[model samples]
Target: MSARHFLSLMDCTFQELQSLIRRGIELKDLRNRGVVFEPLKNRVLGMLFEKASTRTRLSFEAGMIQLGGQAIFLSPRDTQLGRGEPIGDAAIVMSRMLDGMMIRTFAHSTLTTFAAHSRVPVINGLSDDLHPCQLLADMQTFVEQRGSIAGKTVAWIGDGNNVCNSYIEAAVQFDFQLRVACPEGFEPNPVFVERAAGRLSIVRDPREAVAGAHLVSTDVWTSMGQEQEADQRLALFHPYQVTRALLDQAAPEVLFMHCLPAHRGEEISLDLLDDPRAVAWDQAENRLHVQKALLEFLIDPAYQHA
Candidate 1:
């Protein structure tokens, strides 16, 4: 209870993080059984998006409504954040009006700046550097399909973007192992890598990284703003594609995963993504359940029946 902000996976402790996941599972099961609950009554979540998204927008709004709370969408064009106003000032103001703030923006520092000034909880819907909410769904999916995350190995192949960053952070907390395969110049942040020195292992070969891993994860070769460099990236990242041959190096129970809106033949092959062991769809659906649990936790700290 009383979580002031959710800027990154590292923002939460290991136990708190697991609590949210377990609570998410319970909420999901309840919803499937036709149970309804108003856990966040009279709460309003302000969702600010400087970047475009389909899943982020829909999951958060729907999650809020499902919990008996309301969500207000704020696009870049609709807010003064676009015109020139500082996020600090906006954060101070919005914190007074809304119960929580969910921001999907460019820089991680922007959300940090907002959290610094805001009194209410701020969730990192997404950022150029980390996507904690997405990983919440990911962790839930891991637990649901694999039963537990501790001691499991996860392999990441492709551009080391926000999702990969959060995955590393999740591994740091959950006692899991992670191996990443990215092009020479496209490696993850050096600071993050250093922070994970003892906990994580890095590799250059996609196949080598995926070897014996329980879950294989990947994202697009080119992220949203990197469209201009898509051609070059594709050429350079071809070796990192999650193909059937690559998946063969993983454990027999290895589950394939990718954040939605995949490029089919680019970062991952269609056959691999559609494989029976692929848990991409379950990962996407978990987004809603995790957010619902998060909302309930943030709104009522005293309500601890998880």
Candidate 2:
């Protein structure tokens, strides 16, 4: 059988995703209780990064260690893939040594090409087209704070970039309603829009999108490799920032989330995270938990829930 890959949120069944969210919480509890559980003992995960990351890098590396496994970090300069080696060729060789791999790259096609030939599972850490891993953490955080996200209204306020695209997928997979507030020129991919099947609505006004929403989220106005477009994006995205006043337009019980490494005054207000409603820190910490469950599911046959 071919290996399963997580290039996007749609890659997994709804039930599996739900299981992961629950299992992640369980893992977090296990860690908190000082219980040592290492189902993936002696296993190894290869992390290939073409982009720099703080949370993604630390979470995956530390999670593997905590799970009684090991993770090897490979920078673009440290790998043959960055030296013009074909992704398929690199993946074929790497998968022989590693139990699974995660790639954080600029192009989504890079993952597709690598996973096509990889014998081990390939996960998307982040791609220019989608960031499924972050969504897993976000969903897990929401479930921990509020119950099931199904049937809830989610407001996405900011650039309609990769994270927004993942939110669109999450809306369909988790059965939530999503309203995206972004500029006209920065809309998410049309293919994702088509896949949403009406789970999403696009609007230009941030307040309009957050109206009565249960969860409000945003990301940086500019992502890695987009520094050239910073000023222009700042000008276009200024109106979409998630402030206390803007979130007030949502339901009184609404929660806020950001993927982390967020710009203070760009995608959100400077003190937005200080509010009890902002769950950004929890979202960041949950990345480790959710990914630990994912690694167990993909690699350890002993994980009964997988």
The prediction achieving the highest TM-score against the true structure is 2
- Taking the tens digit of each residue's C-alpha lDDT, what string does model 1 give over 48-130? 99889889999989989888889999976998988989999999999999999999999889998999898898999999999
Best by lDDT: 2
Task: List lDDT for all candidates, in order.
Answer: 0.87, 0.92
Measured against the true structure, the TM-scores of the candidates, in listed sequence, are 0.96, 0.98
Worst 10 residues of 1 by lDDT: 297-306
Once fitted onto the true fold, the runs of candidate 2 whose alpha carbons sit more than 4 angstroms away are none
Off by over 4 Å in 1: 1-3
What is candidate 2's lDDT per residue for 1-306, written digit by digit as tens?
Answer: 888888998889999999999899999999999999998899999999999999999999999999999999998798776689988889989999999999999999999999999999999999999999999999999898889999999999888899999999999999999999999989999989899988999999999999999999999998999999999999998988889998889999999999989889888899999999999999999999999989988888667754
